[model samples]
Every structure is written in structure tokens, then in C-alpha cells.
Target: MKSAELNYPTQQQELLAIVHALAAFRMYYLDEPPIVETDHKSLEGLFTQKMANRRLARWYDILAEYQPTFPICPERRTASLMH
Candidate 1:
């Protein structure tokens, strides 16, 4: 497997990028479903919840574009890896 690094100015943008990155990673690397590791657990809930903001709505639309079927798992022990 390969990994990529991304930088964002805001937490919200970073979260959206993470969802995009994980979907890309799964499409490029795994044949079976892949589990994404994220530092923010709130994003897991946010992705499933209805969007209230325009930016969030746009981000959600980008996330939905991937048709991602994999699950997202919050980092259990090493949270600094992504940062």
C-alpha cells in the first residue's frame, strides 16, 4: 500500500480532504473493502448526518461522488500518524 500527505488550512477542509483521500486510497489499493483510519470521530457522524452548511454540503457531495462502501475507524492508539 502507498500513502499520501495533504495539508489544509481549516479543520473542516481537512476533514473533507480525508474523506476524499480515503476513498482514493481504497480505489487504488484494495480490491476488498478497506477501512479508513481517521483522527476525528466526529467526522464519522458528520458524514452520515444531514449537512447544514453550504461548504459542508459541498464536501458531502464530493464524498458521495466516490460511492464509497468502506468503513471509517477512529485512530485507536497512534493519532499523530496522519498529522
Candidate 2:
């Protein structure tokens, strides 16, 4: 994590991981909105709820391009992988 990123809240850090992964392989996911599996309990609300953080705003802007879906997978099923 970058020095500045260390200051981000846990939720933002989790979202950052998603954004970074998506940006890294955008081409393969462009045709279809990728399904991200995680146990992040608020994954659903993360995209729907409003937030005031600038980092989240920027990350959402980047994520908007893919419109990624974050599924609430069971802990055993969620290995931080895309399905």
C-alpha cells in the first residue's frame, strides 16, 4: 500500500483492492461486468450507499467504467477471486 493509502479506512482499502484489480485487466472484463466474490459484508451497500470520502469518490469513478458486481460469497467461497 502507498504511504497515503495507509491512512484510508478499512472499507476504502478493500474497495481499492477491487479497483486496482479491475484496472489491471480491464480488457478481459469489458465485454462482461465481472463478478467479484468476497466476504465484505457491506459489498452491496458499498456501491449503493452514498459516501463523502474523496478516495472513495475517485475509486467509484474508476469502478464506474466496469460497473463491477460484488457478490457476498460465503467465507469459504470468497478467496478474493473473480468468478
* Winning candidate number (lDDT): 2
Error of 2 at 70 (Å): 1.1
Question: Predicted candidate 2: what Cα RMSD to the true structure?
Answer: 3.6
Per-model TM against the reference: 0.51, 0.79
- Model 2, TM vs. native: 0.79
Q: Which stretches of candidate 2 lie over 4 Å from their true place?
A: 78-83
Residue pair clashes in candidate 1: none
Q: How many clashing residue pairs, candidate 2?
A: 0
Best by TM-score: 2
Cα displacement (Å) at residue 27, model 1: 7.1
Per-residue alpha-carbon lDDT of candidate 2 for residues 1-83, written as tens digits (9 for 90 to 100):
79998887777778888899998999899789998777888666777878777767888898888987776878756554545
lDDT (Cα atoms) of all candidates against the true structure: 0.58, 0.81
lDDT of 1 by residue, 6-58 (tens): 34334565566666676667556445444455565566566677776786887
Model 1, C-alpha of 46: deviation from truth (Å): 0.9
- Report model 1's TM-score to 2 decimal places: 0.51
Provide the global lDDT of candidate 1 against the true structure.
0.58
